[model samples]
Target: MKDMVELSRRELIKIITILNLGTTLEWYDFIIASTAAAIVWPQVFFPSSNPASALLLSFTVFALGFVARPVGSILFGHFGDKLGRKTSLIWTLLTMALGSLGVGLTPSYIQIGILAPILLTIFRLLQGLGIGGEWGGAATMATEFVSNKRYRGFWVSWIQQGLQFGVILANIVFYALLGLMPRLEFFEFGWRIAFYVAFVIAVIAAIIRYKIAETPLFTKLSSEGQVLRVPFIEMMRRDWKRVLIMTGIFLQASAGFYIAISFSEAYIAKFLGFSDSFAVQTVILGAIATIFGTMLASFLSDLIGSRRKIMIISPVGVILFSIPFFLLLNSKDPVLVTLAVIGYYFIELFGWSVMPTFYAEWMPTQYRYTATAFAINLATPLSGGLAPIIMASILQTFRGNYLIAWPYLALVSIAYGIISAISVALARSDTAAKKIE
Candidate 1:
């Protein structure tokens, strides 16, 4: 393995770009599923006597992907930690593309009856598996390859941006299609086109990902016979507390994000009585804020010499802003609602931006891929996966009164804030002790 000194600045930039592109495609598919579940799928795949029941069913299937993610983390995490990042990433991309294409091409429930939704569930599970492993591999590859420790946060921030960019692209595509076609037409055929586009994006991402070299850290570990035979088990035995702490920290961010992106759109359009176009526009604006906020937070984390500060502050921001966000949505005015969406996302994305670097820096290289994947993916089902379902259930229970949902989200954010502060403090103490040794 060549030292970091051997890798050029240009090479590092290329690696970051390639890995970011792969995740961009991965999240593009995700946003498509999320968008569909919120709007299109209820009408098409899960048609029922009750409208609320249909939406809940769609969200349930959406959460099923989260249920499968931990399995993906363990399965691909093994190969990722034991084999190579590049190889694992290429396969994850392929699986994601295939799953998306399958969803795009499947017949509607009206045409195929029960078979249609069954197939959709299967494909979504495949996507869950693909993305489960993709994040850790891409994050590890980008962070470990960088020679300068100071700029590591900045580079990993680009990977986070991929998710925001994917949301942007997905919203833009939906916005354009909705603008071009009538509502009936969009529901009939236009939605499928988004998935087809995801497949193409995945192919491009896979090609770029395939061209990148393995990280120097992984190479060094493998060469020195330091790679764990079972990275997930080793992580469990040695770093379970770290894993639990990371998962707890991640849960708040994941739940807050889904509530902002996934649940808000449905709440605005259906419960708040806004148009579908207005809802899509709100999400697009929020995605833009998220991109800007992520970059700003990443840059500031480096400048301030602590990702912990950003992590701790983010959930508190979410908790404080939760009421205003719902109040703006309740206004039913497009402008205020837009402000609400963007304002919450700007703060929420700060935690998202710092997570890649935090996870990468904390875990040892031998089990970094498995540990990071397990921590994040395990949290996904608990927090991100259930957030929309929980919100939807709350709405259902209250007979569509959104006022109750706000407090639930606020409490979750507050818990995340407290846990994150404690975790960050402990991590810093551990780092200081290691340095003293």
Candidate 2:
């Protein structure tokens, strides 16, 4: 395999662009469902339930995708590690496109009765499986292409930025649709247009991915015959503790992000008495902040010379601002709500921006694909997948007092901060142990 130093600037740029496009498509499709779950899916699929119950049910089905993500991680991780990154990524993209197409064409309960939600759930599961594998592959491909180790964080952050861009794009489309169409028409057909658009983007991304070569690190490992026959099993037996640490590290960021982006829209519209358009606009502002925050955090990580310190400190800030975040939202002003969301995401960027580079460096190149996918997918169900439902339940239990949800959010952030601190200590001890040996 060629070293990163051997690759030309053009080749590096090409690789990053291709991989970022794939992640952007994946997140675009996923965010469509998330946006719909909060704004439209309940009306279409769960009309029989009360508004809160219907939204909860929609989010529950949304979580089903996260439930299937670990399986996807293992399935694609196997081929990604043994076969190749490009090959596995192509397949993941195709799978996600299929799910997006299915979702776009699915009829509402009013049209097809109970079968509507069943199909929606099935397609959501397919999407979960695809995205479960997409992140690890994209992150690996981007970071491994970097010639200078110092800039790995900056390069890999493009993948995270792709996700934020998808959120921005999704909200822009929704915002435009809401502005153009009447409420009934927007609810009935406008949302499905976003899914169709996502499917088309996914296909284009898959074609781009297919043309790219495998990463140099994976090629090097494969050529050396260092690849494991059963990478997942090996990861489980040899590096399970690392997997646990990764899961812990991601929990709060994942949950906090979904709550801030997905659940906040519904909370604002339904609980806070804001318009749906205002809620969508708020997310767009937040996503814009997230993109800037990711780039800034990545640049700072390189300058600071420690990803772990940034990750640990970011969550502490989130904990400190949790109450204030809710208070800003409670102001019920669109501008304040937008500012609150942007502030929250800026803090979130600290951990998230460094994750791709951190995970790539933490795992062995031989089974990095499988291990990273498995750990992240496992954490998703616990955090991002359940975030909406958890928040909804909290709102319901507390009788729509948005402020009451702050403690839960704060507790999660504190736990993430503690876990990150412990992980850093464990990593230092492991390094010392290796030196002693």
Candidate 3:
């Protein structure tokens, strides 16, 4: 598994930096929007007589971003495979920049009536489109740049690690704002600052990406005239099963991760009556723990020489913890709630570090970006995008019965984890040390 082009230490470092920055910006923008939906947008853009209705509408808009992701994936994934990763990445970053900037500048409902929500939805969709293709390009670039097949999971994982940093960074910003301003002020104007920060991150990431070269594997494909005209169609015709399996393998994380980080914030602060600062603080702690957990898992995946084994085993943790996680959250005890949040985020996603490398290795050079992005994005809207709305609906449906509601919620997560485990186990392949197909 020799590298097509060997990178010097400095060049490799720069490549990794740009990849991580692009992904970090992607998730940072996503997290801030989630946070805003939970605490800000319902009040600002979707004002209503009934608070719950307003919150649900805001969550719907947030989910719209996830809905637009697959479309983004298809659009940019096409260019990524046919043209170059660098070009696709630059556009994705700028698209996200425009989205975040629009969100930051858009007027509130009081100022602009229905147009506020309409503009907000448009911006959110743009954010989704940008992120839909961002992870695939970043992950593919990282995979192609490095040569050592043995620890490729560990290296590409740095791009995924941006998710943890994004969570931490977003929560920290929100925590600081909540601490400094009154709750009323935060709802009024403080939330806009977070989206502005996202705009800045996109600008920086786009500049770095524009300066970098395309991945060596893609360059080689281009030079040899092997690039596919329609990578998505080619992938579906030949590797559809693999795509489906990969989508299933991602379901556990797709559902549980968003439930814990994005939905739980609203659940904790709005429903459970925790303070905004407390909710943000808990997320920051959980995100910090996840950084270490995922890094350890990456190291283990490489050490074991089987990403599939790690993938198959990790979902069991999610299945086992699903019930307990909700039980802990329902306790209304700060200590228990904090522990539950941390464990929910950490345990279910222990195998996440292997995803980028695993997905990339399964596809041929020409189809890698389109296949990987399509698979992940398909799973995203199915579970990750709708998770908050679903979880909230369950809670509202069984309004007075905490016991029944919590377990019902847990059942949904358990189902996803079980599906993920079975999917990975069914995919009988060992590509850990093999060259990319």
Per-candidate clashes come to: 0, 0, 0
**Cα lDDT listed for each candidate:** 0.82, 0.82, 0.85
lDDT of 2 by residue, 1-437 (tens): 56777888787878888888888888888988898999899899999446778888989999999999999999999999999999999999999999999999999999999999999999999999999899987887776677255566887899888889888888888899999999999888988999999888898888878988887778888888888999998998998998888887787778777877788888788778989999988888888877877888888887767777667666677767777887788888878888988888778656788887777777887788888888889988988887677777776677666567657755654565565556545554221001100
What TM-score number comes out for model 2?
Answer: 0.94
Residue 14 miss distance in model 3 (angstroms):
2.3
Which 10 consecutive residues of model 1 have the lowest summed lDDT? 428-437
- Measured with C-alpha atoms, the lDDT of residue 282 in candidate 1 is 88
146-241: candidate 1 lDDT, tens digit per residue: 635566688788988998888988988988998999999999999999999999889887887788888877887788888788888889999999
For candidate 3, list the clashing residue pairs, or say none.
none
Best by TM-score: 3
* Count: clashes, candidate 3: 0
lDDT of 3 by residue, 1-437 (tens): 23545666677778888799888888888899988888888889887776667777888899999899999989999999999988998999999989999999999999999999999999999999999999887888888887455578888888999998888888899999999998888888888999898898789878878988777678878989998888889999999999999999988888888888877888788778898789888889998998888788788888888888877766899889988898899899999999999998888778777888889888888988888888999999888887778876776677635567888788888888999999989789876887763
